[model samples]
Target chain A: MNNSSDPKKYKNSFLNWIEFRLPIVSYIEREYKDYPMPKNCNYFWSFGAMATILLVVLIVTGIFLAMNYTPHTDLAFNSVERIMRDVNYGWLLRYLHSNGAAFFFIVVYIHIMRGMYYGSYKYPRELNWILGVFIFLLMMATAFLGYTLPWGQMSYWGATVITNLFSAIPVIGEGLKTWILGDYTVGNATLNRFFALHYVLPFVIFGVVALHVAAVHVHGSNNPSGIDIKSKNDTVNFFPYMIIKDTLAICVFGFIIAAVVFFGPNLMAEVDNYIPANPMVTPSHIVANWYLAPFYAILRAVPDKLGGVALMFASILILFFLPWLDRVKIRSCNYRPIFKWFMMLFFVNFFVLGYVGMKPAEGIYLLVARMGLIYYFVFLLLITPFIGRIEKTKKLPLSISNILNNNHSEQNKFQKEVN
Target chain B: MRFIFTILFCFTFCFSIFAASETKNAPKHEWSFTGLNGTFDKSAIQRGYKVYREVCAGCHSMNLLYYRDLIDIGFTNDEIKAIASEYTVIDGPNDEGEMFERPAKSFDRFVSPYLNEQEARYSNNGSYPPDLSVITKAKINGPDYIYNLLLGYVDPPEDFELGDGMYYNKWKEGEQIAMAQPLDEGYVDYDDGTENSLEQLAEDVTTFLVWSAEPELEERKSLGIKVLLFFVVAGLFVFIAKNRLWKSVN
Candidate 1:
């Protein structure tokens, strides 16, 4: 009905005819090419685009891999080896899918951190954050299932250990575990279901990712300064400017992933995964893939099995409450110095917990993990809720354009003084 | 103040806990295929294959590998055919619908020493031999572990006792292994006239095993370099395009 984006505005007859019916041409132009974005968003903002690209890479590679993969526990390991050895460029596809999982998490984690730092989770964008959390959860489930498809010792035992975590429940625990595995133990039924779910969950993640982008587009992008875009002058069209920047970022990310896939393909893979699944011979060390390490640390930190499982679930669920938790007058950590320091400590603690998780849970590692687990909860529950009340805050520029202008003028003044 | 003190306490607690650990670390081996310029030593791999054929093949299986795969490290087609024919593999039979044995082809995978798990376990004193197809990947520090496991056999230290079928190998955790020392000095003669010492045999076999696990290592590395170069060039162009587009705005 709107004449502003009228199909007739375009001289091309075919596009106009198609646009008249579907309006997809105008829809893309408005939503993507002409979408207004804060001009001051930095490289960190590019990670969202990077993550989306990685998701696409994962899906494309995963599909090709599935074509060659056999889901049966007996043949799964051999099939993967066949892919690596015999199938044409199957090695590349397999490496991309596996390493893509890691890279996806890397970019997503950075993107989440970026959001938190700039208060992208605040106010109207809370739904966007919630959708992101959902996507992340789906991704985790998909990755766990994908890992089981290899039918290696780690895959079998990892499934056994994780699914058995359900048995920590009070009454129906054993029933639930059996129900999930489709058998008493992690065997053929478990692998088959996992394979089925693994194939399906990515589409769910894709749907959630679509909702996430839509929600982000509705709210517009949060910039580095966390100042709202006050005028058209404060923003740029998303087409050339943001697209090019995202392209550059994606290229750099692709380079890193390519290096890992080709040169150091096994850099992130556990060596034990190369062996076929032997239910009789339990590996001395059964560690989850690296991305799940921090939560795995939390799970292991508690002595009781149920308590550990509860805490691990709660750890992720707590993120849903983050928007309300760190309630402050100011949005960005750029203005909240104390909160910024705490955030840095929180990130460092996460990394430490991840490291400790990978190490065999013995004396020192356990102690460190326990301490880190405590700090993680403390930061989420206690510190975040209280820090805003006591923290000293810096003055923020009134708008996005004002901040950039101020910085530019200041730089000019410094240059002039030097001259 | 309480937070700082808690952190300090945790640090000390961790330090004290770790200090008590005394797990012996595996000694690193300086191997040919280690760094960026690394490539498999072809002669060593050939010798290692001989070692595998002569000694290790009796127990350990390499079911993933075909006789033709040896051509990558340099084996003549005739040699491969001869190797394949030496082992008779069980196959299905003619119009009678029964099973029979026949000589293998170049593409047939290595035959297992035992027909199945029960047979394997029974023959090896109830301990099944692990497959060597991806042994160099299945274990941690795989090449090093294999090398050390081969040469690690020694007289049991004072106060240490071994059970039947177990040999003392310092390289393995618990300092014991099931398989007795299979190699001695001048164990298998190398056609290339290399020394057949235990260490030499171990090193050569480890190299071969690494290749067996990952035959495309060379292709992967070379392709990685080219892809990286492509990305760099593309990235530079994107960077320029981005800067140029943003020049007027920023």
Candidate 2:
């Protein structure tokens, strides 16, 4: 794959010199340009590229925001206001970063769901899925910290509430919470530390993302047919085909983000966030942002603080065990009718959890949240492991091309008949 | 088609669920700064500033705003200077090493009525009047909520026991609030010959507060439309390109 001997191989003299020295050109060629992706990958496979684009957008916008942002408790609120009002296009940058975080989650969540639905987490791809889970955790942490940088009512209270979750543990729980906050209460120290960590964590995510992509490249991609590649015909190069599909996906994703930033800028933001931090007054509702709402519902489901916190952490940590939990040979839900229904039900349950999260923890919401919590655990823990044993899977195609070619010929015949 | 229907169903369901979950029942109002084509009514903002000066300024402080911000609402620099001069604010120690008070300047933030939160609370029972700079954005449907509250001084139900120093507002959370009704018919004389009724005063000030809460609203919306137009035009070409690229494979 290395073409260092020939100056004519590269696009120009500068690239040729650089390629001779570093071989980065050949590295990219080996990994991306010449990388073999399953030909049958649908639009779902584009989520990873979309998520990566959003990450870059977030980091770029975040840098501009940090330039204008003052992270101190007293100055943070007004600093943000100044950015919005005085700085040229500060509102746009701030809105993009803030809304970018939300959309990043949307894309990443779909990425995870795609992995799950197609068994991308199974067998050789286990490390890839595990690394992705870690990235998700880091993203949640980064987002929660970023939310606190505004230093508004939600920022202050969310900091207080989430940090206090550590105090639910026995013995050192109180001390651990204090250590995390750098104070007995959520104050200047907490804000300073959060601002620092929020800035630092994204680069950490970038490093882990490198590993995740490496892992993916190592084993290649899992296709819809859930069959491993048998020969060159089962795969296509990443250069023109997959890259073009990703470009279109990125364009569509960018359109969505622009629509939000320009039209309903505060659609994902909290109303109370407009108010500066007032520690004396607690807002009536201290809900997390929509991205974290389902987990927040999990946290509030059990009445006991310790129990709720345990269940919440476990809900996320359970993902690490997912590969082993669903030990079935078959991967794609498309071939598993029962598993497809389960996946659909799981999504519906997630929506229910999100709905119940924003509401006050009383009356019917409590009961519904509890039920959602039970189902979330049962599906991931019980049903996933057991369903494959009893359920009859539809016959899988012989190769990735088998089903697609048949479908194409059938469509052509139908067209001819209509003509 | 099923996919499109599912997406629409999800959006509608999510909005309705979230909307119903919000307990606040603030009546909706048509605002000059709402909708796709909406822009700030400059005259209404000016009138609202007048109402704020005469009524709301006694308790609330717009600590985030400078007198210079008035220029956006059609106030001349000379007029803002005149308005700013009427208020006095504290400045730091000079070479003589002493703090001193001086007439406000164009760059100075609107002066607070009290020195600190404790003083602000002491002057108005124990509840400090919150700053009005972001009042509209701080509450759900901020402008509408404020407008409805200003117009929301309905009598309490017979069974309701009113808290001391609290006035009943039909729209305010818990049906009670600390600040008394601050506006009435002919509360202020409008310089532009606009009628000075209670409703008129509320509307003007609500418009002003909305501007303060989101000064970039007009710019954001207009830029959004341009971006959306670009998306449509550029999207068509990209869509065609995508189709052409994938045609051979299918």
Candidate 3:
């Protein structure tokens, strides 16, 4: 066939590329043009997009950092310093990577809270919530492993202590611990393994995040009203509006992250980490990173090792069962006064526990920790279930539309009287 | 939602306990070096430089430090320059007038054995002489343990038999140590007129190693305080903004 006579083939190839090779801007526009976002979605909805942006920032900075980092126990710490001192703008890279981690966790926690407030985990969205939890777990694992790669004193000891937790199991606990450590202690073998895992786990997290988004896309976002979008009038398409909103949010979030990196690079890091790993000497206060501090506090609240481990694990696992735990027919917490109060209290208790976790585990601190711990569990297992039931029986609108209509009528009556 | 909360609460509770216990028992670990005042003996650091130059530098590297850092540890600039110049050469371009990598700079990282990976491994019995820049921090026991371990090497215990290809050191907590205590009395001729004792040398080198590990210790602490101040200011601003934003709605 003469090439000059093959205009149809050229046109066909161009169409194929358009169909298969996803163009970034066009794809974003088409996908989000009429995105069925709720009109009443507030600041809370920004958190998921915020988390997604933070993840990308973290991944980009982390990949750059990895290029210069030496993961061996011997050179890891020095390599990090070399990056700070020698590599061009390496300090900036490190700060962004690290602070990005903190920001990521912060956004994720808020995102999860938003889900809770909106009952986003209920009904067909349960799997979406579950996948989100899976993403959270993977994020935690990846962060833990990545933290060990710097090979700081904290990194080594933190890895050692956490790995040793596996020994809490009854029978083959020691073996399991050894297997995890890959040696008698957290040393070269441990660092190497952590390096390998740290590199691999992020991809696993990426996969899970894909699943999480897919689930979200499938079920669609839960609205502030928690009402189903059954008709065209109730729903919007996925394009333009939401895409622009998300883009703006990402830009704002990125600006904040950049500010953190530029001005206060190691603001969130501990001082002791500047020191290399010393196997014989330990840092006086061996604290986990700030992101894990809350859970760490929870772990410390329990007196027993096995119990603490179980509770620590349960803290994360609890999110998976949120859909069943909430008994209210109503999805949003907006109308549930008692439930609203409990949620606020729970948030305060969690923060308090984080504070206690960082303190010296003394007499009063332990007691407070225990109490906080108790309230934390009660909020979920007892308060939520009980409050939801009580609220359901109390004076309530039959539907979200009914509640809106009543509010509208009340507003009209007030306006009429004023006129 | 209730189950989720319950599990979260339980886990948080457990995490708090673990953290608490860790703090409570933190002092017991040999590796725990929390309150280590970076206040090292200057003479020790000087002595460490000697040991490093004589023994450790031959195979183990500490490419992170400069000759200038030795001044803070006690050497004069003249002494540091003289010492560094012996190891490095400075060259510059005629047109650009920019200094290029001719030899080690005063602040250049310690030199490694110029061997390729295979050569370095083969010569060292598959053990690479790890960089000493953060060796003190990398080990759990900190500088004291590193000092001790360097001096601890001895023949295997009488009762314990030795495995082929394994070197045994009874003084070490572990029976096997990759390094033979490289430092020995009169191993190197010291130009500084310091007494040449193996223990003294080991102490010096360990101190120097610690310094290399955290060269910006003083700066980091000061910067940390400044950052804290900035954080407080930022927090205050955010708090005010939040109050203003929510006032009408509330």
How are the candidates ranked when ordered by DockQ, highest leading? 2, 1, 3
The digit string of per-residue lDDT tens for model 2 on A153-226 reads 99999999999999999999999999999999999999999999999999999999989998999989998888
Q: For each of the candidates, what fraction of the native contacts does it recover?
A: 0.78, 0.69, 0.05
| Model 1 per-residue lDDT tens digits across residues B86-181 | 999998986799998999989899988889989999999888898998998877667888888888888889998887888898888889888979
Every model's DockQ, to 2 decimals? 0.46, 0.67, 0.06
Point out where model 2 deviates above 4 Å: A1-8, A416-419, B1-14
lDDT of 1 by residue, A1-419 (tens): 67556548578988887888898888899989999989988878888888888899899999999999999988999999999988988888899999899888877887888888888998878899999988988888898999899999899999998999999999999999999999999999999999999998998999899999988999799988887889999999999888998898788778867867887677678777998999989988889787888889999999999999999999999999898997785778899889898887898798788778878889999999999999999999999999877888999888888888998999999999999
RMSD after Cα superposition, model 1: 4.8
Candidate 3: segments with Cα more than 4 A from true spot:
A1-17, A20-30, A230-238, A392-419, B1-63, B67-83, B86-107, B110-250
lDDT of 3 by residue, B23-82 (tens): 111123222112322245666666677778878877876657666667677778777767
DockQ of 1: 0.46
Interface CA root-mean-square deviation for model 3: 9.2
lDDT-best of 1 and 2: 2
On DockQ, the stronger of 1 and 2 is 2
* Superposed model 1: Cα runs more than 4 Å off: A1-6, B1-25
Task: Give the per-residue lDDT of model 2 (tens digit) for B93-190.
Answer: 98899999999999999988888989998989899899999898877767888999999998899999999999998888888999999999998999
Chain B TM-score list for all models: 0.87, 0.94, 0.63
Ranking by TM-score: 2, 1, 3
